[model samples]
Target: MLRSSLAIATVTATLIATGLPAAACGEEDKPASEKVRVSGAPGAVKNVKAVGNVPDAQGAIAMGFLQYGHRDVMAVSGEFGLKVYDLTKNPAAPKLIGEVSLPGLWETEDTEVDVKRKLVFLARDPRAYGGTTQTGESGIYIIDLKNPEKPAILSYTKVPAGHTTSCVDDCRYLWTGGPAKAANQPADWGGRPIWVTDIRDPRNPKTAPDPIELARNDGKTDYVHDVQVDDEGVAWVSGRGGVRGYWTSGYHRDPVQGKVRRATAFSPVPYAGGGIEETAAPSKFMHNSFHPSGHRSADGADSNRWRGRDLIYATEESFLDGCVGDGVLTISSLQNSYNGEGWRSTPEKPFRLKSVGTWSVAGQEGSDPTTGDCSAHYFDVRGKVLVQSFYTQGTRFLDVSDPTDPKQIAYFRPADASAWAPYWHKGYVYVADNTRGIDILKLTA
Candidate 1:
């Protein structure tokens, strides 16, 4: 059998010593324990208050913030199952109102909530459920969130691959992507491609029989890690080969064919993208992407930073032995990627997009060497500041007003925190820690 990642052993050790199951939730009333991890600089932004704990959270990876009428809830996806906490009453001390057990689920890496549709999509990855790399049943678990106090499963569609899944066009469809493969994938392919699913009918979902073969990256169907939809209705997919953008709806100028074309979830036309410049990235594994549109993209002091241009913020995830070999944050100019040259390149003709800048935490202040797998995982961009999760390095806040030279503004690293992703919500930052739990923090100068 293939071995687990280096950090998995450490996590196992902690679970054993604490007498907590590898995949179980801690009690809500339990007080903060001395065993919980916490480490950070005196002046840096620190956890204002944390609700979930180690024993309660098997391994929290991703979370979604939602508000239905009078309830503001946080949907946390972890090793054990999906948990929902009400944050409206108290943002820090979230009250656990509901959850659904997904035994043998492997891992719910990420969950997306459709506010209008009152639906939630949970991702089940093969790596966790089957404990294998290339084989297993992966798909999305649909849940009805109409009743926050009690969430019920609407349906489950077993797709080709499911490392991550996201909603497109107001919950009308979903783009599922991955770390491994389906039973019928091409033998020589490195990873899985984006599979489309129709969920217009919340009770009954339909998945396309075939996966999206864009012939991206030298005409090879490489893996697509994740998909993020921007306000302008552009769905961006990121993975090993590189990051690419697509217009899922409406007729737009095809950056590649240089002609206006129709677009849909199953057959999205190439909008803007090419391979990420390898020379600028330590690792080519693009984990996820974020693109803020119009006024939202210019929230902070970096008003003009992305005013007239489209900026693609991506997280590069790598498991290289030392921290130096891990992935970094890549910022690329979407306009530059659409210069009408990179869209048609193939193996015979190679081309890559220009990176606006790339940032890493090798020698950053407050960095720790003992941290397990110090690489970028996931991030959320807000205004000029980008809040990112760096495995064991903790949560970092960077100033991206100047994309070419990102500056570290603040950080929160508790020695035991294995922060996987960060989400900005209601003026507060919520960090999904794989080892600890959901850490709540606020930016302070």
Candidate 2:
């Protein structure tokens, strides 16, 4: 929880000392060279358990989870629309909690729980107009998850949302980013227009007038795709453009721009992988991508204090995935960039991760040979790992003795889309897929 305060304090100090524009603040030192992924066969995750089965599930899309109260039971979330599953019966087969319908076609969703306040918050496009995947959704829907079996709609606050959000700050404020363009004009579609709502009163949550919008996402092709808020409530927001963009990450092209650039790469891109030919950020500049990280589950062992640690991890994706997640299919700049580079810097917290290098399984041409998704991440300090599902790339584990440079200790992936994010508790990782439903893997690694 204090991590956010530290980040903010650090930023404030840097701004004051260097007097440099956030854009000019260069070289965040702390082992930028350690983009490593150690390999260890976490054995075959034969453990199988079903949380709940939803019919016509295009994708399981289990993106977020929360454990509330002294028992600190786990509740999971998915889909851009309405989906609330109850995993209280067992960590594996979560019974049908309840589903609250969204008014319109909503996408780019995330959820959070205020165990202290007994409220659940899920964010999505408010679907005010007839839902169309073209026009993105922009709002946060409030759900009260007091009764795990029966979660009902408590309130709804219409807000802009480009990607997802981090709810570790206070559970009272459901924060999200997505610039609401001039209505029908989809200019700043999903950019950094960070909006925070105060949900102190579960029944009547109100939107706090003052919301923080990231400067970069606001002007360009708006798209604050994802965020990770620390315990101090300082949200680290990120995004990609629908067309073209300019950020501290430098100017980037969307699918539309990439195709144009590639056509002229031979004529324009002076160098090979390191030049315009490598359109992305030039692998040299951006060390990583896919804002991929998660909230360090420092309390999986002690349900009484789930919000103890102040860390969040998220993978980075410049544009959108074509075959996987739906809605506003923005093309990827990862391939077109300066040789497929990702994040501009390494993990902010170095002491948190081990210095193990990537395994031999790493891909040759930035293909992320490991599981397929290049990175499989989670929250594991006191023995807990959270993961992000990358299509066929399965789930991965990290020995979070150090939070920043996570050690790729173990992983499990199917050859198909059935493998998704894994939730760990009591030494078990709950792996769920659309077709596979849910499978609980007891950690033997």
Candidate 3:
């Protein structure tokens, strides 16, 4: 976490020293080198066009979706606060139905939505409003989305972890995690861990005193970034160490504790996961991940490739000097990672998941070699196609049917593109960019 922060700060300082406009949320004046560029194969992804766009939607970091009045509604959060858009009438052009402008709501990269409860959890980073990580307020804003036209803030519950809040167990509770360690935290902590919050009562949420998923980074307590719950109700926690899965509910045999205990949101039982192989991901920081549970291989040649396997598609995010040192998409198999290997893993005896495959936009057909903001951010999967956002690299559509060798079927990277996260809703791809806002794109092929 410190490495990423240092690199970003150095880049910003250099840009300012050279009188160059620092690339941020709403910086309009860009250099000549920052021109629009796009690339894709003919058959892989055809007819890639921007159907609609929110040009002024700068600082757009993350997006969430919910249903209100039987219509698809999108809630986007960033430095400009949260904006709710109606995606029903026009999937391409979203109409801003409601908004909560907080000017400096920093880093809610993956917003959580409770569709059944009509609530949106806006994660508040400790570094929000030009505050330092050592001493800043961190928590979650429970926003009521009952009326899409008039979204209201139900409550702001304070928690130790708040870079991203994920709804687990049918939105009954939330697993809040990361930014960096605060001043009052333990001295040996690498970064923040996951804190459980009881959100059953939306207006009166309470955070657990203890944190889960501790000592994740090779026996050291590191930063826990985001949580993704799969179809089987397994909460996948991704961060500095690697990606790990836990059972948040039900009575299950605890692999770590070695007993049959009832798993709750606050006390989750480790299911599987471990450190990602260093070769596949040099940077220990994992941004986010997706698990293809019960998903069969789409490849006809090797139909049984992923039939009985638990594969995790993760992103190793890091902002280094060049693209090579940056993050990449890694396909890791959790075959032998079960039994709390990641929890008990130590530096002397490290436990790593098997790396099935890896992919990156670095040295690709249409990538800028000079751009430094090329780390992988967030991604979404739909059958064989995996759409991901690679910061300045734009959005990439990969054919993940063959997990071992993921091929880029299509991509959309403009000159000034700062694509943060890409989501697949309905039949189109919605890209949330820090500089370009929301871009609605459709594939012709």
**Winner by TM-score:** 3
Give the Å error, residue 97, model 1: 0.6
Per lDDT, the best of the predicted structures is 3
For candidate 2, lDDT tens digit of each residue in 1-445? Answer: 0000112234346546654311112212211011122222232332232333334333343434556544334444444344555555565555555555542333333445565655656655433234322354556656766675576877766655433444533554555654333345444343234565555665665655544533232133334444444332233444432111112111234232344233111111111011111122111111111211233344434321223432222232211111121111111212232322222112241111111122111331212233312322222233343333433345455443443334455555544433434555655565545334445555445
Error of 2 at 322 (Å): 12
Please give, for residues 1-445, the per-residue lDDT of candidate 1 as tens digits.
0011333353355445644321111111111121233344332334333443434654677788788777798888776678888888788777788888875554555578898867889877765544444556678899987887898999988888776788987779999876554546787676678789999986788999888845565677766777888777888888766778888889878766668888888888777776777776544567778766643443344343455666778877654444676678988777766654555667687677778888887678868765545667788877778889886688899988788899998888776667778899988888888777788788874
Better of 2 and 3 by lDDT: 3
- lDDT digits (tens) for residues 1-445 of candidate 3: 1122333455456445643212211112121123333333221223377788987677788888997566999999876888999888888888888998888676676887887888888888776666667787889999998888888999998888777899998899998887667889998987789898998888999888988888999999888888999888999999888999999899999888889999888888889998999899876778789887755544433322475667899998765556776789999999888787888899999999989999988887667776667777789988888888887778888888778899887888787777888888898898988778898999765
Q: What is the model-wide C-alpha lDDT for candidate 3?
A: 0.78
List per-prediction Cα lDDT, in the order shown.
0.70, 0.36, 0.78
Ranking by TM-score: 3, 1, 2
